[model samples]
Target: MGRRKSQRKNVAMLDSDEDNSSVSSSSTARSDLMSVSGAGDVQVDKDSLLEQALDALYEKRGSTREKALAAIIEAFNTNLRHQFVEKKFATLLHQCLNSIKKGSSKEIALGCHAIGLLALTVGSGDHAREILEESVAPISHALKSSSDSLKTVSLLECLAVVTFVSATETEETERSMQIMWQLLHPKLGSNVVAVKTPAVVVTAVVSTWAFLLTTMDGCSLNSKDWQESISYFSTLLDKDERSVRISAGEALAVIFETGIEKLAAENKTTPDGSILEGNKYRQGYTHILGLKSKILNQVRSLSAEAGGKGSTKKDLNSQRNLFKDVLEFLEDGYIPDISMKIGGNSLHMSTWSELIQLNFLKHFLGGGFVKHMQDNELLHDVFGFTPKRKNILGVEHQMTSGEKRMFQSPNSVLNKARTQFLNKQRMLSKDRNVGHFAFGMGDEDSR
Candidate 1:
């Protein structure tokens, strides 16, 4: 009787049809999984078995996350147990989030996996979307807090799942994308490699691009897409991380092929391609064209040499294989019916325009642009809205009266110009006052 009762506990996947999940149905072999609650020791204290598991999950001392993980995974493993978690999904999410933030490293790992699994299997219904909304909290925390590569990888894997599954039609999609990028951009530097390998970072990045695709409902391609992600990928061609560079090359090749095809189609068949002087899209195709031209030459040039000492053609071929596809695809003049599901990321089109106006094409795009950039801080006043740096800092050294403004320094060109203008005004005022003084009304004589 006890054995039969144990079999009836709620511990399984969100919806266990296995139709959409990458995990095989055969992988779940535990028929008496509820037996894991210690056969008879895990006496039910709550109305639901899953709640009982949660109670155990938050126990003050000596409680292992193994039980909590097993119970949650079991809930996600089969169709029957999914309802229990769904009913208490909010509680379930909170417990997992708490584990991620405050639990031991083992607990944190399980929490990461749990959130990932929820994202992977949670159906995209209204309630499911609500549950998914909770993902941003853990992801934000994990990205900032992960101290090691494996832990970072776990968090990134969760991100991959979240991005993949949440590509549904919704108002939240764009907001989520923005938030993800804001969090991701800061963590993409070489410093991330201190926490994780370059390949792991690349995989996380590729997963992010899955969200950048225009095919995702309610999302469309933007210029920033190229700047934020694709541009970075282009520069990675020369990175020490061979796998990262190779992956970046593949992405660039797809983008180049797709872009040229789109431009050609617009001009050839679309009756009115009068969008710009040199391109059909707008006056903005220059950067795309420039990027396309440079990347092709750069990748082709890479193939001409057996790079590194004693490297064979095989070595060279493997390294530049992505470019081989680009070369063949271009030579054949082939355009596919469907474009690759990827786009770029940037703060705004203005950021690109600013760079271009700075003669970005004639010179290298700049080492600063290649490295870390926060949209808010980097371009708060891209064209100088605030006082000059020297003006602000030089104020203290002068030791002037309190009346002078911080920006009113003698060193600044603008300040010098302002001072000349002010002196001229003061001289004119003195001349006018002299006339009034000499003309002598009764008050002037008294003075």
Candidate 2:
């Protein structure tokens, strides 16, 4: 009777173990079903009732993760209202960015694009700063991802967000500027997909820099930094990629405009109360002027080489287009300050004259293009008298003896004549119909 009782206890224990196993298996099945249902809810077909649900979520201004994603998609769609979409999307963007700290890679990338769309939209407001700060780690990680598309999208989105943030006048703008400056270095700017990225990012960066330098509020970038920016852009101009070249040209135009303004401002200011009182600033102005000349020369050399044989016509066209852009920039009242001051100095006169002559030649070659430099008075000052130098390929080649002598004295009559010549040439060039005698061939051959 003792052995039988022990066997019965053992059988009872086995039955209890089977019952517990059945309960555990049932619990696992319920858990799996719940997980599947949750996944199914999130994974709606692109063209099903799910789209309607997403639309409804966006319409209702839902702040849940699903709603935020739907709003982002709506912003990216081509058929949205500019103002309404931007405002609603910005609201969702803030919520999404706040969650990015704990989000997955896909989540972060989606957030980045949402911010990018906000940047593209007008009236993004102060939210750009918040997005930029929150995106730093995620963007950096995305940039390092093994997937090329992820890296490209991350770069473009980061560029847009930072650009919008830097445009504002708040103290937080500096953070965005710093991030942009770091990204613009050779390591990042020269990224493998630099060619394939959208032009908006490059354009935004250039515009932001221009605004910063021209305005008093933004941090002053050093000359070396500025030079590096130019160098990187210059390299981009030489890239085999067409879009990159076009974007580089646009950026260069902005830089040239700002540089011209800075140069003019420096030239006008004096240590004394009087504008006529020449001060130490002249040396600084002269150095800047030299730098400008160097940059222009480099551009000219690049343009020439890029336009040579074996190059595609499209490539040559781009180089010519860049040259035209530079000319247009210089024409926009840049040299007037110096021109007015040195009107009585022969060397100054000669220099202005040469610049005018080059402008005329370029205009003639660039399909009847006329720049702002070709105003009436500037034309007379440039071409009123005999050219000091003989015309070479429609450009004045050398200064004459009288011009050279005037260049020696600060207030010589020849200097005055030189200025008058420049003013006349400017006027003549202004009249697009006026034929450049220097460039015109004799009619004897036609007869």
Candidate 3:
């Protein structure tokens, strides 16, 4: 009776175990289904909202289209919508271009901004090429009509980015740079007074021009093409605006680093560091060195600049910091090495080109900078940065059941060997147990 009661108790426990397991399994299944459903819902909603914004771009009211563009820009800043871009790249590009073509100053600025973000989002290749090809004419037209500083800066930034990504030939890049340059220092034929551009516009033009200049082959640049640029930048250093001075300093640094330095290194120099006599590039080399001396003196004075009235300490400190770097690079040939931590990974920028590209994109992307740095493949390729892959919760990932099966498939040679080893162990254990049982039985019978 006791044995039967024990068996009944065991049966009850097994039934209870089965029931609990089934409930747990059902709960887990529901949770997983809900998670997947929620993700799908979010993606669908985002797409729907974007579609609405795109439709709004076609509405008759300018305000409505501007608001639509603001919505689109915010969406892009919030997340990289790769699927949406792949599907509607051309449509969005053309619509933004239309805004540039027909919209007011504010609308044109917003449109230029959106197009730049689009080029950055799409990155390099045929898409970037198409962006450049489609945008140049419209942007050039807008620039011709736009006297607004904000609008001009936006258009200039858009042009620089598209060219940076897609300009395969040196001439193509230089063409965009020339357009930016002409905004500040237009070539005049006689008796024409140069309209004084706003200081902010001047800074933007110089900075964007330098940004594109970073990508050009230093050797391919003719001495005549850039000789005037050095002098112009030197003159810009004396501008009253600190921002303009800083921009000019950076452009000078890039020229020294990318172009003149490369030229100097290629040519033979004396042990005293003077250019060898009779060298083909001797005249140009001498000219650059003379300009470099002037720039170095100006940079030194700026680096040690005393705070003056009307200049905010923030701007003052910024100018000092940049000029100090310029001074260091000019005197010692050491470019700035920067390391930034993003999503637990370190991104290092040791070259001026990388620094310029990063700063441009960062300023352009605004709040979206960190998100793109973490996940944008184009940025990764550009900087040679590989960010750690993260799941939705931003934690290290674990294998799913499917992944486990994939790695531990029974058909694999390693798995097959492991299975055979376990089977052999089981057989040996059974044999050993049988021998012990038989030995015990003999001892009992003998007793």
Q: Quick one: best lDDT, which candidate?
A: 3
Give TM per candidate.
Answer: 0.52, 0.43, 0.75
Residue 444, candidate 1: Cα error in Å is: 81
Worst 10 residues of 2 by lDDT: 1-10
Taking the tens digit of each residue's C-alpha lDDT, what string does model 1 give over 1-447? 011212211121222122234222322313223443443444442225555566666665524555666556555433223445456667777777787777766677667766655543333344345556777676667767765655665565555445434445434445555554554455466555543335655544543443233212211344445445556776777666555655565555444422333333342343453434444443333445446555656667655645776656664675665455444333332211111110122222111112221222111111122111111111122222121122365532322233233212122212122223223322332232222212112221211
lDDT digits (tens) for residues 103-175 of candidate 2? 4445555555555544433222344345555565555544444234443444444444444323444334444
Error at 343, model 1, angstroms: 33
Off by over 4 Å in 3: 1-44, 189-192, 265-281, 391-447
- In model 1, the runs with Cα more than 4 Å from the true position are 1-36, 40-55, 61-63, 74-81, 167-171, 187-199, 211-219, 253-274, 278-283, 297-447
Residue 9 error for model 1, in Å?
46
RMSD of 2: 30.0
Worst 10 residues of 1 by lDDT: 335-344
Better of 1 and 2 by lDDT: 1
The local distance difference test score of each candidate is 0.43, 0.39, 0.68
Which 10 consecutive positions of candidate 3 have the poorest summed lDDT? Answer: 1-10
Better of 2 and 3 by lDDT: 3
Candidate achieving higher lDDT, 1 or 3: 3
